[model samples]
Target: MKVEIHNVFKNMRYKFFQTEDGIYYIVEIKPSFWKTLFPFLYWFFPFPVYKVEDEKTIEGIQTPESWSFDKSSAVLATGGVAVFIATIFRGKIEMFKTELPLYIKIIFLIVMIFCVFLIRLFVNKVKFHDLYKHVNLKQLERFEIKVKPQSFKHIGQMFASYIFFLFFSVMSYIMFFLDGNVFVLIGGAAMLIMFSLVVNITVKEGLTKIEFIK
Candidate 1:
């Protein structure tokens, strides 16, 4: 889908325009409902969704690629969860080297494509923990900004990712034996997030960072 950035407000939230087959879609990406309620949740799991202008229902499912941020985030979080399990079982593997199931292999291939595409298009659009040069700061005072820098596509992507990961987990039963290797699960997740971050730095232009890949 071709999109033209229509407006960008402080904290990097606003509306963007997409024209497909002569139909105009205004996509809004902002703080999620949960984030709005909890405020602090945005720091750990900021869920964003996409919505059509004047529409109440979220259509994040229509364009799943835009939601790659959620996919990456979910992968990392799942790895962390697996790590905790492995630690409990006293397993010592930093990475999982088991054979991949056919369906899982297919999903993983798609994940690879998403990873590459993300670095090219979506990751560059994210602005988490952004530093403003011109904004003056007082000595020893904490710099604060209310709005977080985020792409309009984030919210939808968030939900889409959750559904996919849940399916993957259920199908494999987390690979049955993964319940044992604490190091492998955690290491695998760390590697995945690290690779995504590296791609963000290599493919994404301008300043490089290792924050939210939205």
Candidate 2:
């Protein structure tokens, strides 16, 4: 079955179908155009094929509670927006008068791009648990269906990230010590943390594949 993905920018479709063994799979049919255009905006964000273990039947998805500025998500969104705006206007600011090297400029640009996505990441309020709404409870036959886990698809992409970020983090630490550039140090720290996460996930994913094969 096809379900309309909730997109603020454009209408897109997500495919969800059931198999003979009572397994359900949800796959992306048409990705959001904006996401395609700006891949960096959603980098490292997981869009996993969920496994539903519970036998409970669900009706349509219920709307989540309204967002409040007092919440931590709201604070993160506001902070990301502010940092993105500052990055855009950094050239005009008096404190940043000294022109940065090309590599540093590129690093800052990448960080700024991440900031843009940070806002979206925090502001997005979707509850994946509620995604069972795709299954119609009214259809009595659907009640017996239990969704099983699917094999991973983006393991290669994650491994590539691990390589790139490992090199980047090493160079960042070296450059920071040599030139005493605090910005580079900060960027390096962030990339190092990201690299560690990628390594951990990649290992887990590899083990999962081995288990699946067994």
Name the top TM-score candidate.
2
The positional error of residue 119 in candidate 1, measured at the CA in angstroms, is 19
Q: Report the lDDT tens digits of candidate 2 across residue range 142-204.
A: 221211222345546654776788789778867754565656666676676555334222222
Relative to the true structure, candidate 1 reaches a TM of 0.23
Q: In candidate 2, how many Å is residue 76 off?
A: 19
> What is the per-residue lDDT of model 1 for residues 150-184, given as tens digits with 9 covering 90 to 100?
34344344444444443443434344344433333
TM-score of every candidate relative to the true structure: 0.23, 0.32
By TM-score, how accurate is candidate 2? 0.32
lDDT of each: 0.36, 0.42
Off by over 4 Å in 2: 1-20, 23-53, 57-155, 199-214
The deviation in Å at residue 33 for candidate 2 is 37
For residue 98, model 1's alpha carbon misses the true position, in angstroms, by 14
Top of the candidates by lDDT: 2
Q: List clashing residue pairs in candidate 1.
A: 48-155, 49-155, 49-156, 50-156, 67-157, 86-182, 93-183, 93-184, 94-184, 95-184
